[model samples]
Target: MNHTRDKESILQLYNKVLPKLAERIYQNLTEVTPLFDDFRLEKIVDTWTKDRNASTDKEISIENGNVQQLGLKLSLIGFQAAGAQTFDLSKDLLFSLDYSYYEVGPDKNSRWMEKPYFEEWTSKELDDIAVKWSEEVIDEITQKLQGL
Candidate 1:
């Protein structure tokens, strides 16, 4: 009978709950994901070095979500060898999580259910995300190598 009152109640509910929902989403995205870990960077570096005749003792240090090459160099046929180059490979590794709110119109009101549902991501999906991030790191390394 009172449409304005119903909309006010919905807005009030969204205002009360959205911040916590956003925080939980951010924590779940960043804390559990291995995207910024050293192991991930090592995997990327390993993949890159696997094709090249690079040394086995490639060292990497990730501090505060920043990937720092301890002492790595590339000596390709055309490019001269640059000794002990430290690359800030974290540029591509930087990530942020975002969430948005949408108001359903009368025509689209039936599209979603009354309750919101969240499904835990499968291992395969997580692996796929990791692969994407690995590619980003590889691209950054390749660009740095080209500049040398």
Candidate 2:
């Protein structure tokens, strides 16, 4: 089997399909921006890019004309703070508005205070968009491979 053709196909798939997937994800994120309180999440969504972090390199490879080990890393700032809120009581102290005792702050009193905006967006919304886009790309590549 001539692996060169397979390699070429994989490269084509990466070049053509990956950006579309990224764009779709970006669009989905943009649509859900109103659900988040933090402006940083909106900033990250607006700046989403398919640079080095979103490429398939050595860690990902093409095998027998089939795209294998393909992966994408969506690099964003403050991604760690996206899920749940964690405070270190040993190193940090929680003070109330009057600075008397430990009490829930004003921000925590909000309905959306339980989970970070980015966390909800990534886990629920982004996951669905990514899966749908991935399946579309895979199906397209499969069709192309069949032709080859």
lDDT of 2 by residue, 1-148 (tens): 2122244544443454334445655564453333334222111111222224334433323433322223233322221223433211110111111111112111223221122111213344335545554344345334534554
The RMSD of every model to the true structure, in order and in angstroms, is 20.6, 22.8
Q: Write the per-residue lDDT of candidate 1 for residues 5-116, one digit (tens) a residue.
A: 1223333323433333333333433532333223221111112212132344443212111121111121112222346244343322211110122221112222111222
TM-score of each: 0.30, 0.30
How close to the true structure is residue 79 of candidate 2, measured as C-alpha lDDT?
Answer: 16
User: Which prediction has the highest lDDT against the true structure?
Assistant: 2
> What does the lDDT come to for candidate 2?
0.31
Candidate 1 regions exceeding 4 Å error are: 1-84, 92-117
Task: Evaluate all candidate structures by whole-model CA lDDT and list the values in order.
Answer: 0.30, 0.31
How many residue pairs of model 1 clash at the backbone?
0
**Colliding pairs, model 1:** none
